[model samples]
Target chain A: MKFLCGIALIALPAFTFYCWLLLDSETFLSLLQESIPIQTQYIGLSNRLLALVPGLIPIALLMRGAWHLRRLFGLFAVRAFFHEEIAQRLHGFAFMLVFSVLAKPVAGALSSAALTMNYPEGERSISVTIESGDLTTLFIGVIFLIIAWVLREAHQLSKENAEIV
Target chain B: MSILVNLDAMLAKRKKRSRELAEYVGITEQNISLLRTGRVRGIRFSTLDKICEFLECQPGDLLEYKSNVDLTQ
Candidate 1:
């Protein structure tokens, strides 16, 4: 599982960045068009890229947090899960998950606004989706945060108990 | 942290080295050092009994309480 997470920690961002490049670069726009069909025409490259910034930032942060989580799990595989470092990493993962879940709607709005910014006055399509998955992700993030808190308390008690020998 | 250990004074009065006491108690010298410095949170009853037996003294002879409040008041 740790090894798989390590692979994902590296691969997810690489794929997201590749998608970003395909979307942002004119040179790769043809590839993007060929791979994914979209009716909306992109306008004002700078503004579009700028708008995409909000979305990309969260994705990057999410990837970074997952990477940290993977490392923490790796430590756990070596029986280091009872340490404060594990608790810290769990907290970090929980926070990043929360941020990612909350930022999704904002990213969706930014993308929709960016794509339709310069479209014909009456023909622009702005789409906002509220997915059930988003709610599930938010709930999972909250659960992870609660688990982190419990782990923190457990680690503290373990430390105190170890000292009592 | 509030429990003061007088293991060192007892050892000195018994003319016993910490290492010797630790060997007799079947514990490590490092733990003996911890006890002498009052750094350990608590000692096991078996270990304390062993130490007391080895030192020829009661537990009270090797342990003291330093209260934060003034009990006299």
Candidate 2:
């Protein structure tokens, strides 16, 4: 379990850096076009950098979620299954997931606007999208929130049981 | 907080060490110590039963209800 978490912790930032900086512009634009349904002309370096500004919101949220998940896994690796902090970290991760989902459309619109900002005035566009995948993520986040609540209840029960004999 | 553990007194009357009671009760000596000091929240019925059987005492002899005692103090 810890091994998997370690791999994920290492992979997350590497993957993010690759996607954000290392990937070629044409490939990145093609991927963006697939997700955002926006027409792209020749995207300048300035516009790509500008798009990263709005993109930072969801990225930050996801990174925060990963941080909490790592902590939760650390506790689990030590067999602290009912530790109070387990529920707290899980709650934090779940909260981040929900907020990240909520922030996605806003970030997408701003990023779209940023990407197209170099276009002629009438052609510049901001597109807000809510896909089925976003809904699925929202649902999973809500389910995780409920699981966190349940874990808190279980932790309380464990605490009370520990007080006995 | 109102319920006081009289385990130490019971152990003295029974001529049994906390270690002996802990062994008979299948619990740790630390838990036995906790029970003796009245520092525990509660005791399980099975543990209480084992202690009672080992010490030849009733539950009432091992526990006392003291009214108007401030636990926080």
lDDT of 2 by residue, A45-89 (tens): 788778877877877787788888988988988898778999899
DockQ for candidate 1: 0.55
Task: Give the fraction of native contacts in model 1.
Answer: 0.65
Candidate 1 whole-model C-alpha lDDT, 0 to 1: 0.74
TM-scores, all candidates, are 0.77, 0.86
Ten-residue region with minimum lDDT total, candidate 1 chain A = A29-38
Residue B34 lDDT in candidate 2: 82
Task: Tell me how far the alpha carbon of residue A132 in candidate 2 is from the true structure, in angstroms, after superposition.
Answer: 1.4
Candidate 2: list runs displaced more than 4 Å.
Answer: A1-25, B69-73
* Top TM-score prediction, candidate number: 2
Tens digit of per-residue lDDT, candidate 1, span B1-73 = 4577888899889999999988988878888888788787888999889999999999999888877574344
State how far residue A110 of model 2 sits from its true place (Å).
1.2
Per-residue lDDT tens digits of candidate 2, residues B1-73?
A: 7898888888889888999888888999999988888888888899999999999989999888877656555
Q: Report how far residue A152 has shifted in candidate 2, in Å.
A: 1.6
Q: Top lDDT: which candidate number?
A: 2
In model 1, state the lDDT of residue A68: 71
